[model samples]
Target: MEITYTEAVILYCLKQLKGERTIFSLYHLYQGKKSSQTIQDAHLYHLTPFFQAFPFISREELARQIERMEKKSLLDKKSNEHFILTSTGDLKLGEYFQANTLPPKYLDGWRHHHLTALFWERLSILVQVCSNLVYQKKSFIPIQNKLETLDWVKAFIKKRQEGRMGLSSTLFLELLNCFQRDKTIDPSILVLRLTGQDRIGLTSGQAAELLGMDHTRYQLEFLNILHFLIGTVSDEAVEFPLLNALIPEAEKPVPFTLSTEKTFQLLNRGYTVEQISRIRNLKRSTIEDHIVEIALHIKNFDLAAYVPKDKEKRILEAAKETSAKKLKLIREYAEDASYFEIRLVLARNGDQKWK
Candidate 1:
């Protein structure tokens, strides 16, 4: 049987989304990959709302698409956990990968689409959150107990920003209004709600109090309404930031190279963070971070052989000079956290620092 252009393209998209089960699952469901009890549930409960968030297709249409994809063998229907791509799907995906290099616009700006979806997904849960808060407020005593209101708010924020839900601006404003009416609401709670930095969404009573109310049902309901608002219909278009949260005080940069280098060196030596902390005179968390940077640089260029020899030498030397003298100037402008201190250091040293 001859494959149509649309079917081929759909197959290609499926292959491109190889490992992201949620994404492929949505595509599979839309393509009509298979019809089973589990697939039905995934479609009705998970994929449907997810698609609604993007305003891409109706729930019924999505299921139909999944069935179609299954008939074509582009998507494997047997697995409940993930949508495994078939050989035909792989070949189609390879065709697109080779023939169509992504435009710079997509490469650079695709992140924004993802970030926006994540924001909206979280916002969807705000209504449920407020409804619950209202429930507690009306009930006289807190429904969740010493469980601070801020904690629930934090968890919801984390869930939404984490790209686990569809957030919306309307929901955001509603939440703000809730806090306004309840002046007792802490600003930290609001901060946690937006940034997902702290604990905000702890549940009432459970072994894992952290579980809180699994807002999946709440998310599903608001997901439909939000899709109409954002003006999209498919889960594919839904996007959120992969790394969209603030770094904590512990993550702040320290000003020394040997400290950075040694921390990394110890970590590479297979030392646990705690071991590294004890061995090196730095905090365990700080040592663990050094491991990350060291791994990044090594992955980019060989650190052991390159250090004090080639490109790595020049880079480190520059970093050190910048660290020792130039960095001191930026310390005064501490309030300007967004600015890069490395650049400030380089600017101060001018030609003297680069050698």
Candidate 2:
């Protein structure tokens, strides 16, 4: 089935998460919410790369797409908060994968960089120089205006040549193959233009007009394509030193908030939430929120430590019946189960199967 980019992205995210995800989490991921360290660490925000391509999409519009997808039987509403891809949706996504070379939202980690413009500028300049050199043209003017950048690119090219013969050719061929296989022509043309391929090469402004895209959208697409190429080539660096040198380092560790780290430390020491709250001079509710955040981030966190087996059984049953949407309704069904316990159960097991 033919699906819009938004629908395709939604399906891809659901499948990647094993066919189930909360609406809230999905929205936060696509909207690129920075509040949650766990989401950032996982590189879950896929929409940031295409902000210009999808300028019209908003959180509200995304929610509408989810509803539309559910109505189309592309997704099954498992609960008020979560949805799972249906068999039809799975088959459709499989078709998309078979037809498309580049995975949807492939350069999601680019959003994490603070100096994205510099990264792209340096990369494009390097590619242009390398492509020209491979074609045996040494007299071309530098695409980058800065003297420092020109010097750096010159030294970088020299180092690769000294390390291995045909390194530049190998890197350029790999990039060409990746772009040629892509479902979209824009990315391939963008890369070709940037690298100064003989017939198709054009300046950025000229390429944007040829592709019928605005300058911003064209630039965003080009950057995403470059990022994807860097990632793909970097993985095979053991065989391609030139590619390895071109790609940047992986993301740094995501830091937890001081309060959340303190709460985690206390919990690790076997302190009860109440005890932690008393010792830390915070409310019990605040302590519980910290525990939830910890459980969400730490895969092996023991939710059972706070919720007894019998009480967990009651909460799971109530959650299954009512979809875990409203905690108050769950509390009514699960008599004597504290709100915190209910929240914990929902947080840990809402999208997964209950024991």
Candidate 3:
């Protein structure tokens, strides 16, 4: 018998379904079981909800379909509540499924696609070049070898806009800073910024500023995009594990005696100020203060010996300049790192650590 697409779809869902009830629910009461007085009630109860959501199949209609199938020997009626498809049914269903699906060539990207891997691998190069455009809030005018980079930027933006990218607005805005203007940053440069000594990961709030949207809206939008990027189509909700990795775990403030050592250890372990607060039962603001103070001390310590002195000096200078205005300049700088980089020079410095 020729298998219909509808039949194939039903079979696939049935095979993949978990739990006895769900399986029993999807399948029509085939076997002589539904005719039995004892099992008939159970079949009707399970069948009701399924029918409502499905093609609104009536019990009479389903019985007729089952009878037809059985007559054709496509299904075997075992007991009152149980029915099994014959070997022909299995073969026909498999054939229909295979016929409906495209060849492997059409699914080439699916075999190796992972959003986090794609983002991390592409980000360093993409963000560095796009930083300029982001800072300028201007579209990339492709020239030189910048076309590929701009194309990537366009694609990334499109994905975000379509809710197919799981990035937060804070992250989106942070990303925009990299491509804001005509800045042609190398991927290595952006990578360095993320991995630098004075490194701080982008926050959800900061990401909101980047997208020019309110934090709450951006957060929802970002989560949806993440869902799309992660390829989830479940009726039940799922969270991406990569999100936890994106931001460090929150950390509590340590006293000065243990601050430096502890901060270094936590930073290496991906602990954020917020994480620290929860861990230490301290306030977030207090933890931030401790982290800032410790960071400053690290900058002051001839740990300059461990780093490139000139680059360190330049970074210190930029921080000093940004700090002078403090609030406004800091916000501006954070909002547009590509623009801030010229005046700031430390735009992509954090990425260096990964190298």
The prediction achieving the highest TM-score against the true structure is 2
lDDT of each model, Cα atoms only?
0.38, 0.62, 0.38
Q: How are the candidates ranked when ordered by lDDT, highest leading?
A: 2, 3, 1
Off by over 4 Å in 2: 1-28, 36-125, 128-167, 176-287, 324-326, 350-355
Q: What's the TM for model 1?
A: 0.24
Clashing pairs in 2: none
The local lDDT score (0 to 100) that residue 103 gets in candidate 3 is 17
Q: Report the lDDT tens digits of candidate 3 across residue range 1-355.
A: 6854445534443332212223344433322122112122222122211211222345665556556666776666656534566777667767776655411111111111223233433443344434443444344432324555546655665545423233433445543443342242222222332421223335556656765644433433433333233232111122333222222211212123354356556655778667777877877655544443344324333333233556545544545554322234544434433222222232223212211
lDDT of candidate 1 vs native?
Answer: 0.38
lDDT of 1 by residue, 1-355 (tens): 4444444434544443343344445544443332222133232222222222223445566456656877887778545534557787666556655644222111111112223344343342344444444334322222232343436445656666423233445345433543454353233322322322122433212212223322332222233233232222122122312212211111222222466676665555767667777876777555534543343323343334222234333433544543332233333333332123232222222224222
Query: Model 3 segments beyond 4 Å from truth?
Result: 13-24, 27-55, 102-355
Off by more than 4 A, model 1: 1-87, 92-129, 132-137, 140-355
Give the per-residue lDDT of model 2 (tens digit) for 1-355: 5765456667876655443346656555544444433243233222334322333347787778889998888998887767888999988887877765334345544233333345556667877776676677767766668887787777776766433237556766665666665566456445546645253357767887887755544555665665565555555666545555554552323334578789888887888888999999999887887776666556678877889989988988997786533578788899899988887776666446432
- For every candidate, C-alpha RMSD to the true structure in Å: 19.2, 7.9, 27.3
Clashes of 3: 51
After TM-score superposition, what is the CA distance of residue 23 in candidate 2 from its true location, in Å? 9.7
